[model samples]
Target chain A: MLNIKNLKVSVENKLILNDLNLKINPGEVHAIMGPNGSGKSTLANVLSGKKGYEIQGEILFDELNINDISVEERAQKGIFLAFQYPVEIPGVNTNVFLRTSLNSIRKSKGEKELDTLTFLKLIKEKAKELGIDEKFLSRQLNVGFSGGEKKKNEILQMKLLQPKLSILDETDSGLDIDALKIVADGVNSYKKKDNAFLIITHYQRLLDYIKPDFIHVLSKGKIVKTGSAELALELEKSGYKNL
Target chain B: MKNQNLNINQEYKYGFTTDIESIKAPKGLSEESIKFISNIKKEPSWMLDWRLKAFKRLKTLKEPNWQKPKYPKIDYQDLYYYSAPKSSSNKPKSLDEIDPKIIETYKKLGIPLVEQQRLNGIAVDAVFDSVSVATTFKEELTKKGIIFCSISEAIQKHPELVKKYIGSVIPLSDHYFATLNSAVFTDGSFVYIPPNTRCPMELSTYFRINASETGQFERTLIIADKGSYVSYLEGCTAPMRDENQLHAANVELIALDDAEIKYSTVQNWYPGDKDGVGGIYNFVTKRGICKGKNSKISWTQVETGSAITWKYPSCILQGDNSVGEFYSIAITNNHQKADTGTKMIHLGKNTKSKIISKGISAGFADNTYRGLVDINEKATNSRNYTQCDSLLMGNKCGAHTVPYIKNKNSTSTIEHEATTTKINEEQLYYCNQRGLDQEEAVSLIVNGFCKEVLQQLPMEFAVEAQKLVAISLEGSVG
Candidate 1:
C-alpha cells in the first residue's frame, strides 16, 4: 500500500532519516523496532507530510507520488498517523472533530457524507468498542484526558476514518495491559485485505497482543535486520544492541 | 509569506447601495440643524425643547480621547446630520401606501417588510438612512398591550411613555457621543412591555446607512414594566463609502420590579477596505438599569464590523437581589480596531453580575477589552465575576485587556480571570492531519474558544454569529 525509495529527511541541516527504503503490500503488518534516536518517529512524521523537513527521494502511495501533497490531502487520501503525544485541542469537541474529519474524507472520495444523527450512532458504537466513555466524546478533544484515554481516542479516530494505511507512533507507551488489549482488539477487528499497518515502537510489548507479519530493526536511520514475528521475542531477550 | 497570507480578498457582501432621492438636512451641527430634524419628525414642543437642551450641552462637551484607537479629526459641520428617503415624507398608514422602491431596498437586504413575507414570530422595524420606514407585526403586538414602534411614532402617539423614559437610563448630557445622539438623533425603535405581561415574540430593529457622507444617530429605549419580560435585538449595516461615515447611537434599557430584559446586537457595519481606506466609526452608549428588587438585565453582542468601535454596554444594579450579565464576542480583522467591554455597577445590597468577553484580533488589527466593576459601600454581600479572553492570529495583530475594579464593602467579592493565547501551530497541524483544511481548522478552533459567549445569543442569531466569527478571521492563518 505504501512504498518508500531511499527516503532521507533532515531538519535545519541535521539529518534524521538517511537512505531508508521500505515497501508494504496490502494486508501486511510491518513493525519497525528501533532504539532511542533511531529516527522512528521522524519516518512516521515524514510519511504524514509534516512541514519543516527537507526531504529527498520519493514517497509513493498506490504508485502516485505524494511528496508535494499537503498534510490534509494525505489524510484525505487515506493516510492516518497516530501521534505519540496527541495534541490537546481546547474547545473542539471530539465528536465534532471526528465527524468533520470523516466527512472531509468522504467528500473527497465522492461519497455522501453522514448526517449528525447517523454519525453519532456510528461513533458511539466505535467508542464502545474502544472502551471510551460517551461523555469523553462530548468534551474538548483530548483536553485533560488521561494517557490511556488519549491513546484510545486516537484509535477511535483511526477506526472512524478507516484509512487504508494507518501509522501508529508509540501509541501503546502509556497504555495499561487492559487498555492495550482493547486497542489491539480495535486494530485486529478493523484489519482488512485492502488495508495495512506500520507500527513504530521502542518496546516489543505491544507486539504480543497484535502480531506483525514482519519485524524490522532500524539502527542509526537504516534498517539492519528483518524477520518474522519471532524476531520480536528474540529481540526482546537480546535487545537492539546485539542486532 | 505571512503578509501575503494575511492579505484578505473577500468582498464586503452588504456593501451595495440603492439609488433613491433623499431629503437631507444641510451639512452641519447647530441649533438650526436640531430644529430642522425636530420639524421633520413633527415632535411636540416639550420634546423639541429637550432636544435643544441636549444640543446646548453637546456644544460644551469635547470628544473623549481615552480610547486606544485614534482617528483623524471629525468635523461635525461637514457631515449631513439627517438624510431620509424622500418617499417617507408622508408617513404611510399601511403597507400599500408605502413607496415600492423603499420596500424593495429592505427586500434586497433580506428583511421583507411586506405582510406575507415577514419573519415568523419576530417583529422588525426597518430603519433606512435616518427614518423608520416600517415596523412589522404591529397589530399583533398591540393586542398584547405591548408597545413596539419607531421612536418617532412613539413620540407622536404614546407621548406619555416616551416622555417618562427618554434619557432615563442614559442622561442627555452623559458624554460627548451620547449627547450628540440626543441632539440630532433621527429615528430608532422604542418598546414598552406592560406590567405582568411577557412579550410574545422577539422584537428586532434593522438599521441601514445608504446615504454617503451622512451620520446615523439612532436612539433606542426599551422599558420592561413590573413583572414583565422582553427580548430585543438590533442589527446595523452600512454601504461601502470612500470617505469615513460616523454612526453614534444611544440605547437605554430599564427593568422594573421582578422584570427582565435581554438585549442583543449584531453590528455588521462596513469596516472599510482591507487597507483601511474607508469605513464606519461606531461610537455607541448602551446602559441598562435594574430599578426594582429581583430584576435582571442581560446584554449579548457580536461586533465584527466597523473601522473603529468604542462602546461599553453597562448595567446599574440598583435593586436588591438583581442580576446583570454581559456576554460579548468582538472580532477585528484587517485594519479594524475595537475597544469594547462592559461595566457592572453594584448599588444595592446582595446584587450579582457576570461578564464574559472574547476578543479576537487578526491581520494588522487591534482589539482591546476595557471594563469596570464597581461595588459601592451599600452593596454589601454583592459579588461580581469577570472572564476576559483574547485570541490573536498573527504577529502583526494585538490584543489587550484593561480591567478596573473597585470594591468598597468588606463583604463584597470580585473575581477576575484574564488570558491571552495565540493560535498554536501544533493544534492547526493536528486538525489538518484529521482532514480539515487550514481555514476550517481555524474556524473550528475559534468557534470553540467563543462558545460560552455564543451560547448567550438567541438561537436564531447564534448560528449567524458563529459563521461571522469564522468569516472575520479568514486569511488570518499563515
Candidate 2:
C-alpha cells in the first residue's frame, strides 16, 4: 500500500533524508527504530507533503506517484500522520475540527456525510474506547492539552479518519508507562486486515504491546537493517552502538 | 472559476441613480447660500442667525490635512448646497403614496421603503438627499414615550430640546467638515429618549445621495437622558458618478448620568474603480459626550466601501466613573483610503476607556489607524487600554498606526499596543491544502484577524459583518 524508492529530501539546502527506501503491504505493521538525528521524523514529514521540502526520487502510494499531491489530498487518500507535537488551533473546537476533517474525507471518498446526531454518537463511542473525557472534545483543538493528552488526540483523529496508512512519529516519546499502554492499545484496537501502519520509535517498550510484523533499523537517513519483531528487543538489549 | 466572471461588474451595482428634477442651489458656498438653505426650510430667526455664525467660522477653518488621503483640492464653491427632488405640498401619509422612483432607488440599494412581510417589524426612517421620505413604527415608538423623527420636524415640534443640545458636545467650529455641516446641513435623524426610559426597538436611519453635483451635508443628534439607554444605527450608500462627489456629515450624541448610548455605522459609499477614477469623498465627524456620572458611550463602525474616507468617531469621558469604548474594523481595497480611529478624553476621576481597531489593506489601498487617549489632571486613577492591529494582503498596499497618548495625571494608567503583520503564508497554504481556493483562504485568515472586533457587534450584525468582510476581500487576492 506504500512504497518509497531512494527518497531524497532536503529542507533549506540541508539534506535530511538521503536515499531512503522502504515498503509496506496491507494488514502489516512495520516499526522503524532510530536514534536521535536519524531522519525518522523527516521521513514522516516528507510523506505528509509538508512544504519547504525539496525532494528527489519517487514516493508511490497505491501505484500512484503522490509527491505532488497536497497534504489534504494525501489525507483523503487514507494517509494519516500523528504529529510528534500537535499544533494548538485556538477557537476551533476539537469536535468541530474532527467533524470537518471527517466530512471532508468522506466527501472526497463519495460517501454520505454524517449529521450532528450521528457524529456525536461516533465521537462518544470512540471517546469511551480511548478512555478520553467527553468534555475535551468540545474545547479548542490541542489547546492546554498535556503531552499524553495530545498523543491521545492524535490517536483519536486516526480512529475517526480511519486512514488506510497511519504513520505514528514519536507518538510514545513523552508518555508514562500507563499512558504508553493507553496509546498503544488505541493503535492496537484500530488494526484491520485492509489497513497498514508505520510506527516510528526510539524505545522498545511500545513494541511490547504493538507487536510489529517487521522491524527496520534507520541511521543517518538510510535503512541499515531489516528484521522481525525480535529485532526491537535485540536493540533494547544491546542498544544502537552494536548495530 | 465560473463565479469569477459574475463579480466583474460588482462595483457597478451602486452606479445607477433615479431620474428626477430637483430644486438645486447654484454651485457655491457663500453666506447667501447658507441663508437660502435656512429660508427654504423656513427656520426660525435664531436658527438662521446660528447658520450665519457657522458660515463665518467655516470660512476661516482650513481643510484638515491630518487624514492619509490625497485628492484634487475640493472646490467648495463648485458644489450645489441644496438639491432636493420636488414633491407634493402634502406629506406622503403612507409608503404607497411615495414616489415610485424614490422607492426604486431604495430597492436597488437593498433597503426597499415599501414594507414587505419580512420588514414589518423593522422601523426604518429612509432619508433621500435632504428629506425623510417615510418613518415607519412612529406610532409604536410614540406610545413608549420615544420621539424618533426628522431633525426638521424636531425643530418645529420640540424646539426647546433641540435648542438645549444642538451643538453642546461638538461645537460648530469643531472641525472643517463639522463647520461646513453646521452651515448648510438640511436634515437627519433626531432621537431623544426620556429619562429612565429604555427604547423598545432599534432606531435606524438610511442615507442615500441621488442628485448629480450635489453634496450631502446631513446632521444627526441623539440624546439619552439620565438613566436611559438607546442603540442607534446609521448606513449610507451613493450611486456612481464620473466626477467625485462630496459627503460631509456630522453626528453627535449626549449621554447623561447612568445613561448608555450605543452607536453603530456601516458606511458603504461608492469606492472608486481600480484605477481610482471617480467616487465619493466621505469626510465626516462623529463624537459622543458622557456628561453625567457613570455614563457610558460606545462607537462601532465597519467601513468597507469608500474612495477616500476621513473620519474619526470620538468620545469624551467627562463625568466621574464614566466609560468610553471604540471598536472599529476598517477595510480599504482597490484604491480606497481610510484614515479613521477614535479619541477618548478622560476628565473625571476613575473614568475608563478602551479602543480596539483592526485595519485591512489590499490592492494598492492605504489604511491608517490614528487615535488619541488623553487623561486630564483631575482624572485620578483613570485607566485606558488600546490595541491596534493591521493586516496587509499584498505588498503593494500599506497599513500604518499613529497613536497619541497624553496623560497629565500621575496616578492614571494608559496602555497602547500596535502590531502590523502580513497574512501567514503557511496558514494560507494549510487552508488551500484543504481544498479551499485562494480567495476562501484569504477570507478565513482575514476573519480570524478581525475576530476580536467582529465579536463585539450584535449577534445578527456580527454574522452580516462577517459576510461583508468576505465580500469586500473578494478578488483582492492575486
Candidate 3:
C-alpha cells in the first residue's frame, strides 16, 4: 500500500536519507529500528510531505505519487504521521480543533459533517476507550499535558482519522509501560486488512506489543537488514553492532 | 482569507470609498476652522467660546514625541477640519425621515440602522461623518431614565447637563491631540444612567468617516449615576483613502457613587493598503473616573486597523474600594504602527486595578505597549497587577513593552509581568499535518495567545474580534 523508490532526503545539502527504498503491503506492519542519526524520523517526515528538504525520487500510496501534494492534502489522502514531539497550541481547545479537522476531511470526502453534539458523542466514546476524559479534551491542545497524555492523544487522533497509512515515529520512546499498552491497543483497534503501519523506533520493546510482520534495521539512511518478528528480540540481546 | 497556503497579502475589502454629498470646511487648523465647525453646528456662545479657547491652547501644545513610532511631519493645514454629511442639515425626527442614501451607506457598512423589534438588546447611535444620523431604542431607554442621545442634541436639549460635565474629566488643555479634538470636535454620543437604575440594553455607537480628506474628531461622554450600571460599546471605520487621515478623539467615563461602567471598543479603521500607502492615524485619549465610593470602570478594546495608533485608555480610582480594569488586543500588520496600553491611578484607599494587554506584530509592523500604574500616598492597601504579552508572526515585525509604575504608599502592592513569543513553526506544521492550512494554524496559535483579552470582550464582539485577529495577520509572512 506504500512504496518508496530511491528516496533521498537532505536538509541544507546535508543528506539524511540516502537512496532509501521500502514497501509495505496491505495488512502488513513494517518496523524500522535504528539508532541515533539513522534517519528513522527523516523517513517518516519525508513520507508525510514535510517541507524544507531537498527530496529526490518518488513516494507512492495506493499507486498515486504523493511527493507533490501538500501536507494538508496528504492528510486528506489518508497519510498520518504521529509526531515524535507533539506540538503544543495554547488557547485552542483540543476538542474544537479535532472536530474541525475531522469535518474538513469529511467535507472533502463528500460525507455528511457531524454536528457539534454528534461530534462530542463520538469523541467521548473514543476518549473513554483511550482513558481520556472530557476535561482533557477541553484543555488547550497539548499545553501542559504530560508525555504519556500527549502520546495517548496522538493515538486518539490516529484512531479517529482512520488513515490508510500510519507512520508512527518514535511513538514508544517516552511512553511508560501502561501508556505503551494503551497506545498499542489503540493502534491495534484501528488495524484493518486494507490499512498499513510503518512503526519507527529505537528499541525492540514496542515490537513485543504491536508485533510487526517484518523487521528492518535502518543505518546511515538505508535499511541494512531485514528479518522476522524474532529479529527484534535478537537485536535486544546482540545489539545492532553485530547485525 | 480562505486559502491558508496562499501568501496572505490580500487587498482590504472595506477600502472602497462611498460618494456622499458633504459640506466641508477649507483645509487648515486655525481659529477660523474651529469657528466654522462650531458655526455649522450652531452652537451657543459658551460652546463657541470653549472652542476658541481650546484652539488657542492647541497652538502651544506640541505633539508629544515620547512615543515609539516615527512618522513624517503632519501638515495640519492640509486636512479639512469639518466634513459633515449634507443630509444632516435636515434633522430626521424618526428613522423613516432619514435619507435613503445615508441609510444605504450604513447598511453596506453592516450597521443595521432600522431597529428590527427583536430583543437584540442593543441601542445603536449611528454617527456618520460629523453628525449622528440615527439613534435606536431612544424612547425605551428614556423610560428607564437613561439619557442616550447625540452630544449635539444633548447640548441643545439638555444644556444644563452638557454644560455641567463637558470637559470635566479631560480639560481642553490636556494634550496636543485632545486640545485639537476639543477645538474642532464635530459629533459623538452622550449617555447618562439615572441613580439606582441599570441600563436595559448595551448602548452602542458606530462612527464612520465617509468623506475623504475629512479628519474625524469624536467626543464620547458616559456618566453612570449613583448606584447605577451601564455598558457602552463604540466602533469606528473610515473609507479607504490614499492620504493619511487623522482621528483624534476623546472619551470620558464618570462612575458615580457605587456605580459601574463597562466600555468596549472594536476599532476597525481602514489600515491603508498592503504597502501601507494610506490609512488612519488614530490618536485617541480615553479616560474614566471612579468618582464615588465603591465605583468601578472597565475598558476593553480590540484594535486591528489604522496605519499609526497612539492610544491609552486610562482610569482614575478616586472612590474608596473602587476598581478599574483594562483589557486590550492591539494588532499591527503590513507596515502599521501601534503604541497602546492603559494608565491606572490609585487615589482612594483600598483601590484596585488590573491591566492585560496583548500585542501582535506582523509584516514589518511595530507594536508597543506603554502602560502606567500610580499609587498615591492616601491609597493605602491598594493593589495593582499588569500583564503584557506580545506575539510576532514574521521575522521583520517588532514588539515592545514599556511599563511605568510608582507606589507612594508602603502598604500598596504592584505586580507586572511581560512575555514575548513567536508563532512557532513546529506548531504550524503540526496543525498543517492535521489537515489545517497554514492560515488556520496561525489563526489558532494567535487566538490562543490572545485568549485572556478576548474573553473580556462581550460575546458578540469576541467572535468578531477573533476573526479580525486572523484577518490582520493574513499573508503577513511570505
Highest lDDT against the true fold, candidate: 1
What TM-score against the true fold does each predicted structure earn?
0.97, 0.87, 0.96
Residue A206: error of model 1 in Å? 1.4
Worst 10 residues of 2 chain A by lDDT: A88-97
Tell me how far the alpha carbon of residue A121 in candidate 1 is from the true structure, in angstroms, after superposition.
Answer: 2.6
Please tell me which predicted candidate would have the highest DockQ against the true structure: 1
By TM-score, the better pick of 2 and 3 is: 3
Candidate 1 recovers a fraction of native contacts equal to 0.67
Error of 1 at A66 (Å): 1.4
The interface root mean square deviation of candidate 2 comes to 5.0
Which residue ranges in model 1 land beyond 4 Å of their true spot?
B1-8
Better of 1 and 3 by lDDT: 1
What lDDT would each prediction earn against the true structure? 0.91, 0.84, 0.89
lDDT of 2 at A69: 78
lDDT of 2 by residue, B369-453 (tens): 9999999999999999999999998789999899999999999999999999887666655443343445655666687678777
DockQ of each: 0.58, 0.19, 0.56
